[model samples]
Target: MLEINLNPFTELQTDRLILRQVRESDAPEILFLRSDDAVMKYLDREKMESLNEARQLIQDALISVKKNEGIMWAICLRGTDFLIGTIGHWRFDKAHHRSEIGYTIRPAFWGQGLMSEAMQAVLDYGFNQLHLHSVEANVNPNNQASIKLLEKHGFVKEAHFKENYYFRGRFLDSAIYSLLKPKR
Candidate 1:
């Protein structure tokens, strides 16, 4: 069996990005990302309609970290603290050494390859630092950009389930992708 701990939090860095702990001040950015039509287009989750909702989300992220339930990072530029997006590994299956990865970026930042950078860092931490056997991504089949990004990172499509779940008053399909730890 595998046991994990995320005390004191962990921060990741890339040439142009800093992935750090989520803070209350990130509510505005969280609100935008959770509510913006473009950002929420393929997301099956609920939208944040108010700053209060966003603040609650920030709290939830913090609690999840403290409980070792999961870990989330606020994606910001290296020299800044403002969050432009968020990424995390959650829905852990410790018995199997697997976890689900999810991310959301402001539409304004799309096409810049920034999310790709963040994803790579997170995947590395998941597989190398956390000793995860695999990382999984559940994406909306219509989300081509996300599918492409996952593929570029070597997450091969493992399954495509039609109308597997219902969200926002409709049935939606899921394209499941997974990346195994490289042979060592």
Candidate 2:
């Protein structure tokens, strides 16, 4: 049987980044990520309008961890605690030892390969610490950067659904990618 326990909250580390639990104080950074047009461009989610919303998001994320349902982390530099991005594995299918991974970085930090480092840390935790059998990502078809990132990490394109989602009064396409746990 699949087992998960995020109790005590697992903090991850890479050479240049740290993945720590999201805190209430991170509301401003979270707000910027959820609200910024460039950051949320392909997310197709409602923009955050206030810090309160970001706080609520943090609470929800914490609840998920407490319940062992999922986990989210604020990505920061090793030296500075400032959050430059966030990443998580959610929408778990524990019966199959599967989960969906999601992540986003501030627009200012783009093109730095920082996300790649963070992703490696998260994947290490998901596969080794969490014992996850497979991980998946749902991405907007137009997001080539994300597509390339997934590809670079050994995730393979699994499917593409044409106009399967309705957002902002229009239907949008989705591309699914997946990776399996590497053999030891």
Candidate 3:
């Protein structure tokens, strides 16, 4: 049997958000967002029906991080117990020095700029701590909010795949945006 090594998850803080590993206790709150149709509209999963489902999802996310499959971070407000959302980098290509970033925030927190703050911090970590040369985010073309958010952080559209994702029955296009390390 092959022994799998796990990365020790740690907590990160910025001025307005706390980024950390998702705990079992966060399953309920996560499920709430996971169940929100508005939130899941752009996500792969339709909805989570139970806390156990969210727990299982959390477990898998952590395992993936440990196995270097991905790094998932829960986004929480400073001094608060409730998790606002999640952010992560998957599709890592270490040899190429790049990765893909994905994030989601609760509907209540939308328009508050909480997610942007979290994203900026994580993107910085991806470039500085993870030593990545670039990162990308693939957003549904119709999701103007997400596209604008990525643009604010210097991500430029590299490609536009029309009718790429099957979401809620209809096909959707996606905008592939990428950010390269600033030239020093």
Candidate 4:
């Protein structure tokens, strides 16, 4: 049986960012971000119309983390600890040693390379702590920034599905990418 230490879930830090679990109190901040169409445009979920909805979402994420079904880390600036984004991994395939990653950042924090740093930490957790062989990401084809970021991390384009996601009253193509840990 594969045993996970769980220590990494406590907190993760990079030079410019702090990655930690989401909390119920995070509802307000999340709502602020989710209320913006620009931020929710690429995401599957609709813009949060109320704080209650945001609270529910954060509560659910917290529950999932506790159940070990997945992990959602709130990304923040190191010094101020401001909630800037979130990164998550879920749909674990233990037998295959793989999982899928998803991420979102506030528009204010965009173009700062924060997602790349958070992704590196998440990838390390997947590859080293979870002992995963591969991690996959799916991005909307029109989300060029995310495509570039994934490619920067050596994730190869594995599949391109046409109009796979019917979102926001539009058909969206998805580009699937995969990254495998280099053999030691």
lDDT of each: 0.93, 0.95, 0.85, 0.84
Model 2 alpha-carbon drift over 4 Å, by segment: none
The residue-by-residue lDDT of candidate 1 on 1-184, one tens digit each, is 6676878799999999999999998999999999999999999888889999999989999999999889999999999998999999999899999999999998889999999999999999998888899999999999999999999999999999999989979899999999999887
Candidate 4 collision pairs: none
lDDT of 2 at 28: 99
Candidate 3 lDDT, 42-73, residue by residue in tens:
66657889999999989989888778777888
Top lDDT model: 2
Output the lDDT of residue 118, model 2. 92
TM-score of 3: 0.90
TM-score of each: 0.97, 0.98, 0.90, 0.92
Q: For model 4, how does the per-residue alpha-carbon lDDT over 60-166 read when each residue is reduced to its tens digit?
A: 88777777677888998988667888898887777777889998899888998999999999998888878888899988878889889999999999999998888
What candidate 4 gets wrong by more than 4 Å, as runs, is 1-8
Superposed model 3: Cα runs more than 4 Å off: 1-6
Candidate 1 collision pairs: none
Best candidate (score: TM-score): 2
Off by over 4 Å in 1: none
